[model samples]
Target: MNEQVIVTGASGFVGRCIVKALLVRGVGVRLLVRDPARAAALFPARGVELVEIEDLFTASVETLQTALAGGGMLVHAAWYAEPGQYLDSTRNLVCLTGSLHLAEAFVAAGGRRFVGVGSCAEYDPTPGHLGIHTPLRPQTLYGACKASTYQVLEQLLPGAGVEFAWCRPFYLYGEGEDPRRLVAYLHARLAAGLPVDLGSGEQVRDYLDVERAGEMIAEVALGGRCGAFNICSGRGQSVRQIAERVADGYGRRDLLRFGARPDNPQDPPCIIGVLEET
Candidate 1:
């Protein structure tokens, strides 16, 4: 844990958690961020270094290499994840390209280990339960881009003598979650004593808190594990069940109104991850 690890998007939701987990484990961290002041305010802990990049998705490989120097490992958690619009945004393509550039820089900088964050969307959701062996059939631009990065880096990084791992997270909630996300929205509404609308609430998903997900990703980065790993709760819960559970926290289960909002026809009916390890 003493080795220095460079983390991109250190100011982001998942990224910030990952940085915190690493620091808690006594690992030195170097944050690659667009805003150094913001990152510094987020992590007022010792042994944290912030390296600013004007735009990670547009930074030159040489610039990234210089910024990545001295860090033996990297946890890449940055992406254009602007809630509602990110699913089909062209920014996914930019992120894909920039991630490749960052990988190139990592290799050039003599980095030994590279851990990238991915989403469960990289798999075909029709299967309901996803495992490491599941065939990838990403249905959206964001999933495609993530799957593409995994495929390319799976072959590219190892060939370049750099160890690599990909952490694919399922439905993540908890601290730092965007208000537009399901869990956050439910809390905002329920805490305010307002009615929370939802769809049929039948779709099943695997939910994991972002803090646990971050610890798992940090484990992957610090350990010798390679290839893809699922960061999930390993259990399924219906949307209704999750909503009710959140509502129960505020003693406002009656405020939850299922079927109030039309369900997105494109949403998969179920998505549960099969954890490969403890």
Candidate 2:
């Protein structure tokens, strides 16, 4: 395999971590981003190349081919993930089409491996441990798009002689996480000594540190792993537990206001992934 890896969404939260992990391994990296200046600032180091594109959704086939050329692996992590609007965003259709185009271009350009980041939402939200074999019944546009990509590419790429893997990540929290996300919101509220409004606090979820998740993603890209893998901690923890943990860290558990906010009726009571050791 070629030592160079091409990564889309290299400036996003999870993408940045994956880039860092690959760089630490002394792998040559080519980053595709809409903003070259921002990616440069974020990853200013040796062995990394930045390729600026106006938008992946509208990027030309030639542009994708150029970025993917001679790379051993292509990690497609870019997608529209705006805090409040992404779940049902129409942009997901654009992502699905664009990502599929990129995958096709990568395979034609001799890329040996293709790894795309999926979401736990792609699985049916029944309360149980989700595995790679779990039936995919995505609930939202975002999940549907991811599941669609996995279904198409899992069959398309390998037939074209390109190794394919889809990584489904559970709740992720760490540096660069959006402030509107659960962990960041809780941490911010607790640190300010303010009451943190929460729901019933009984919804169980699988949370994984973003850094570890990135490492696992990088390993999948560099290794010979194929098919779907869950990037998660495997263990389940309630929303209340996570809030309490953050509050405790801030020395303000008393400030936690469970039941202050109403729970989303669509949210599954429990959604955890079955562990897949790297």
TM-score on alpha carbons, each prediction:
0.98, 0.97
Instruction: Report lDDT (Cα) of residue 47, candidate 1.
Output: 95
In candidate 2, what residue range of length 10 has the lowest lDDT sum? 1-10
Local distance difference test, per candidate?
0.93, 0.90
Candidate 2 positional error at 263, Å = 1.1
- Give me the candidate number with maximum TM-score: 1
Backbone clash count for every predicted candidate, in the order shown: 0, 0
Candidate 2: misplaced stretches above 4 Å? none
What lDDT tens digits, residue by residue, belong to model 1 across residues 22-113?
99999989998898998889999999988889999899888898899877899999999999999899999999999999999889899999
lDDT of 2 by residue, 23-142 (tens): 998898999888988988898898888888889877889988887777778899999999999999999999999999999899889888899999999998774889988899999999
Model 1 TM-score (2 dp) = 0.98
